[model samples]
Target: MIAVVQRVNSSWVEVDGKIVGKIGKGINILLGVVKGDTEEDIEKLLKKVPFLRIFEDDKGKMNLSLIDIKGEALVISQFTLAGNVKKGRRPSFDDAEEPERARELYEKFVKKLSEYVPVQTGIFAAHMKVFIENDGPVTFIINSKEL
Candidate 1:
């Protein structure tokens, strides 16, 4: 499992011109489930994301967490995050998990995150147009394999 987390002032996902999910003053998570990812991977990220101290404190230091600030979350399924471009010009998605298993884990991830904060999600496997107003332009790329 991999998560590309971006701190955002606001974010929303649209499918076929209809908005499906949206959030404000929080983190936008583009989650990818790769082959071999398991429940443990989801657990690790669930523990880390909310508590990550990326938000700024009153003193202007980056010490506040999403939970500390009572923020929301916008989670989106993004299988393309697993694309490999090391060889050919065309990206290969062989590392991505099958849709059924990927959606299962994706839902599990969102369920766990909702326990910590208000959570919104894009429709799984849909063609989505994401609009994000990045806060501090802050972002982090977390890979469960690295954890």
Candidate 2:
């Protein structure tokens, strides 16, 4: 499992020109499940994301967390995070999990995130148009395989 976490003033996802999921001031999480990822991977990332101290504090320093600020979350399934581009001009998705397993883990990830904060989500395996108003432009790439 891997995640691209972004602090956002707001964000939303649209599918087939219809608004699907959206959030207010909070984090927008783009999550990916690789071939061997499990529930443990999702559990780790769920704990890490909201507790990340990317929000500013009293002195305007990045100190407060989403948990401290009581923010929402928008979760989107994005398997391309595992895209292997080193081999050739075209990226390979052989590292990505099969769609069936990916959807299961994706839902598990969403459920885990919802445990920490209010959560909204994009449709699994759907073509989505995502709009993110990145605050602090703060982004972090987290991989379960790394830790």
Q: Rate the local accuracy (lDDT) of all candidates.
A: 0.96, 0.92
Off by over 4 Å in 2: none
Error of 2 at 40 (Å): 0.9
Q: Per-residue CA lDDT of candidate 1, range 39-69, in tens?
A: 9999989889999999999998899999999
Q: Which stretches of candidate 1 lie over 4 Å from their true place?
A: none
* Backbone collisions counted per model: 0, 0
Model 2 agreement with the true structure over 1-147: per-residue lDDT tens digits: 989999999999999999999999999999989999999898788778889999999999999899899999999999999899998799999999999999999998888778889999999999999999999899999998776
Q: What would the TM-scores of all predictions be?
A: 0.99, 0.97
Write down the RMSD of all candidates, one decimal each.
Answer: 0.5, 0.8
Worst 10 residues of 1 by lDDT: 43-52
